[model samples]
Target: MQAWGYVSHQIPLLSFASRLMNKLLAERDFSGQEICHVLLNCELQEGTRVVRAVDCRPYEQQGRSLRLQGDHDDDAEVVGIYEKYLSRPALHGELTYLDFLANWNTSKRDGRKWTRWSRQAKPRVLYYFPRYKSNPQHHQYDDFCRVKLMLAHPHRDPNELRKINGVEYDSYASAAEFCFANHQHPDDYYGTPNAEDRRPDPDEFEEEFHEPDLLDEDWLELARQLPDCPPSQEMVDLLGRRDIDIQYDWTPHVGRYADPGIVQGDYWRQRIAQNPLYMDVEDLPSEARDTLNAEQRIVYDTIVGHFQCESEEQILLHVDGGGGTGKSYLIKVLSSHLQKLARNRPSPIWRAAPTGVASNQIMGTTLHSLLRLPVDRAFTELSPADANALQNKLRDVRYLVIDEKSMLGLRQLSWIDKRLRQVFPARAVEFFGGISIILVGDFFQLPPIANKPLYFDGPLKDLHEASGQIAYRAFNYTVFLQKVQRQQGDDQASFRLALDELRGLKLSIESWKLLSQRVQAKLGQRDVDSFVLIRPMSHTLDPTLPHFKFLGKRSRKCSGAARESCGQWRAL
Candidate 1:
């Protein structure tokens, strides 16, 4: 039957038959014809039926004729011996002819040995298939299968395994042992088993499977399973559709799992597309240019000059402005102009702020988030991979507008300088990666937290000098926005005078009296509903009033209602 099977498949077996006959004739002391009969019809059992020798005479005649061809001379014997095993099956030690055939077919379908099969099956075993296969009564057997899969998968997070299978093993060691005893090696089988075949139907196992909540813990667990690279645009969009709120702090972890370049590129591309910053110079909106006061116009002109200059000649600019000046408005104009110029390419203009709230006001991201700097460590301490990602992100950035610069520290600024230098090594001698940087903030508004301010001129300056760090010296141009666009007439003049006096620590009695007049009397009987009372200590005020309190704490309800009433109230 085996000989006929080979013949029907058109598989050449003349050489194999010759080698078998020759071996039997030499080793078993049997004639070539007897060997042929044994191969074709012998059952190798006493009293079993066997075919008559006459039926196998054809095969014996062919083998004997080939052997006779090898008897003439030494050269003929050598050639005949070579031809004998030329088409013979290359079976492994102790493996049968059937085993060799099965292995050959498997190797043809998949290259290499079972190594590839083991690797391809490992992830599916641990991640795709559930722990159990049969009914709940066969839970023990299912546990054995899961444990076997877990053993095959290296770098397996125990927590992830438990979460995926919805079962926690007492320990990895115990799980490994259980798998060893119950699960058979894949090599013991002919082919790789399908994960679905080993797993019960989804409907049958739905009750056992619990979907994890989309919480931080689950996100972290999922992140652990992902490969270290930036995610593709599709993955990011899918995540957005799912409304997974990936926090800024989690970016480093998430970034490693996906391709950072793709994520950041797609993110910024979408942001620029959605932004209203692409206007022609001639068609610049009146709101951007006409609304600026004289002081703001000068600051705007300086920023425009920097943008218009050759990239190599552009200088870092600092726009010093108090609370009421239109600094934010100027930044918008500059951003729009630059973005419009580079609409065909990635936007050269980028905005960042120290705080999330401040960044949100300008439709930008936190500086640390933009830089991908670790919150717990300095920017200089970024990992090599993170530093490369940061460099790639800033490679095309030409203009960076940093709002609330006062809150940024001298050390942080130096770190920024160092990182920029690393990104643009050719321009390391230049300031801020040879990019036009506009720092917008009033130095007197809020000093840097837990560090010396950028403008500090005391021992901090000496410390900076000793550390070879550049401070405000990096700014080649400075423009002050002095016009108080938020207030007008006596209110504006009086407020300026009070601020100046307070800054100089020389508040005169006249200045104090001028401010006190704005404070309404708390004890007096007043129509609180008709007019808003301005008290120094009051947290809540009437919603109809033009003036709002700027105490230490914010009254969300009162402020929200007042903001809703006016529809245009800018928080002081």
Candidate 2:
């Protein structure tokens, strides 16, 4: 009987209803209160109802005749409530009528009404079952049951009042479907405290129980009190588990939060674990260092000087150049040189780009993936625990290289700034958590999608744009690489000139002609044949390709062998 509280939703209401009715009939001599008590304690599933379509008939054919003979005209009364009162917009008045009828049908009656029972038992049957009264759909199901019982003829067999708990056309004809339509998710009902059963809101709690906002300074002061030695096993276990409640008021730290010291120590421990030895710095290849031109060498030395400087002042650097001017190559060499200097202390340089393709060029991850930034909205502050976790992950990082800087919008830059500030709260006021930032890209390339460009001077839309503006203005050093490194030989001079004109958006007549001559339409038959065909649709490209004529003459039917060869080209 105790299991009644945890009754499976898989059990059909019809089965429970029929079982209750049988128990009631068996205890006919007992008082109403006694029958209620007995039924509440009895084993369920006894005398379970099994519905069959053959047992049911339309009301007009058999129910009307049976109702008139048995004087069960009151059956029409409950069915009228379902159709008429439920349809009215004034639900308060109609529900009052339903409650009165339900009570009237269950009570002892006078004159033509039977004292023991109503001639129509549909209302009485529905009134007896109140186990699922708290379920939101229970009232709707009751009305459905009433309408179905009144419209169906079951040959006076109470167990066969209807075929299912819902309309015949509905998918809720099965028990699983019925439960899904009625009950909430199992986790909502069983895993957490029910809404009605939970404690009052924090505002309602006594003043002493309220949790004050523990500021960063307050957290730091608490951390300074801890001993400067190895953490005890107890501290290690506490740091490892996520479920430990750090905010719980306890002795020796009743007013302050308990986790900040633990989180800070864990962060420092991770940084110290990556200790770089003197012998780890390998000598760079002389050719790699010697290959840099005068312009490239100057930029390299400027960045290296900032890295080796004893001061904590952040180096906000911008390395600007056009395509094929060795921007990517410069970044690679800079990252390599910096890594050698840091000697194996984790990765002192972190590289990221706005796109996967661009990131692949620099052997880095996408900015969004690297920073775990949200794409759909501007960045928001992270929870303390989450910020601490991110801090631990990037503890040894000192330099952040952002490639494809032109594609990075105001909002994304703000996200990076806000995230770094959270990760290193000690330097919250510093730009990018005091880590030197290097931005490298051609400014004329693709701009950020669906957001204002980083250099936009228009009125700021929100805090993110304002923050990005401030961060952008903080760049004190810039290195411009104007010398074209990739296209240097005489054979590429014309193409290089044309690209320069295109990048500047001032293409001349000669440059236009040079670009046009390389188009597919101007290519010779030999050049066309050398090119591979990639189109999936053979017919679409048949007239375009000069080699199509080799397969067959335009006016004639091509041979099967030739057509097969053409089809293979199309597949390629």
| Reference-based TM-score, model 1 | 0.41
- Model 1 Cα lDDT, one tens digit per residue, 506-564: 78898998877754464334543456653332212122121112111221211111121
Every model's TM-score: 0.41, 0.44
| Candidate 1 segments whose C-alpha is farther than 4 A from its true place | 1-287, 378-384, 460-471, 490-492, 523-572
Q: Best-fitting candidate, measured by TM-score?
A: 2
Per residue, candidate 2 scores C-alpha lDDT tens digits across 216-263 of: 445589999988998788887787354556555457656454556465
The clash count for each model shown is: 8, 0
